[model samples]
Target: MRRINGGGVIEETCPSWCAGDHQDDQATDLDDLAHSSTVTALQMRVNAAAPSPLLSAAILQSPYEDVTSERVTPRAPYVVFAPSDDDFTIELDADGLADVIAQIRQHADRLVQVRNQLMALRTGMKGTAAMSDGL
Candidate 1:
């Protein structure tokens, strides 16, 4: 079901069973309906030579999108947008997730420190900034 609540997010939510892990979940009527609809839509686009929604999402957003290994996963898997706007969907095992979490924490810390330094400079560099340029 796709609907906007108070927040205007276009969420695509299927039944819990329909959204289960592909390796674990067995095929069901709901799955068949979802699959067929998706296939039909893609086929129609192909037949008409119209742009596909899937392809639209994959279009390049920037020339310098960071293609990094360490990215936060909102769910079990991580969906990363590369420099070319290409989406790379990854399934991280326990170890991989742990590594990513650690990396995210480190980056968060660095960001906080950088923000503080910038704020200090903006308010009053004074004794904080050693170099003239930094001030």
Candidate 2:
């Protein structure tokens, strides 16, 4: 048998089966009704074209837009961008070029070190091979 509570349908065995030895448990009936409604709603949502509310919004945000720039010519002599006021028009001399290369190599080495430390903390550095000496 079914009865309406809070605009939801609650299912129960015949009242005769629940009388004398059993009485209507309002709490249990309400919980079952609520659970049934929730499951039905979730199933409907899953079958819909747009399941979760965030799915459509996330889809709309993709396909990044293009931006125009003044200085970034297709064929600039060097990758020229002044990061700060103190370092404008920094051209790559032999030493400066070497320094830049070494800085990049050092940054990569540091990343590996940090990754190794993280692995050690996370999984006791299990099966991690030692970094090669030759770069």
Candidate 3:
């Protein structure tokens, strides 16, 4: 694909999941020349609250390659997580992402346990109320 800023042809092939070219030709900085894949929307909610905000997940690749610098180098494509509100972003590699998934599973399991306990409490309250009505 062609770089918008007259950088010439892009040699790398787009990832399978990439929707389209996101390279900004008019980008004034190298950081803005990064390529991004189509974002996958993760509908996340806290405590079962309404109006769940969407979390955007995508794979990103840096624009430049084969540069030896103390501050930067050619980096492998990595996943980026961001909120729909565009507040902040977190980037992670495969192993880091796996850790995040594990943590989420642990939290989800805890939530399930709490839900079961709440259900039991409600059930017991219902039985007590029924007996009180007979009194």
Q: Pick by lDDT: which candidate is best?
A: 3
Error of 1 at 57 (Å): 17
| All candidates in order of lDDT, best leading | 3, 1, 2
Candidate 2, 1-135: lDDT as tens digits: 344355554444432211122234343334332111111112124554654321010001101112242323211222222223233434333455467568768987999999998977766434333333333
Q: Name the best candidate (by TM-score).
A: 3
Residues forming the 10-long window of minimal summed lDDT in candidate 1 = 55-64
Candidate 3 per-residue lDDT over residues 1-135, each given as its tens digit: 444354545445556765655544343433445567877776666786764546667887765634553323355677887756466877777887787778768988999999999999999999999999999
Model 2, which residues run further than 4 Å from truth? 1-89, 125-135
Number of backbone collisions per candidate = 1, 0, 2
Winner on lDDT between 2 and 3 is: 3
Q: Candidate 1 at 14: error in angstroms?
A: 12
Please give the lDDT score at residue 13 for candidate 2: 41
Task: Quote the RMSD, in angstroms, for model 3.
Answer: 4.0
lDDT of 1 by residue, 102-121 (tens): 87689879999999999888
What is every candidate's alpha-carbon RMSD to the true fold? 17.7, 26.5, 4.0
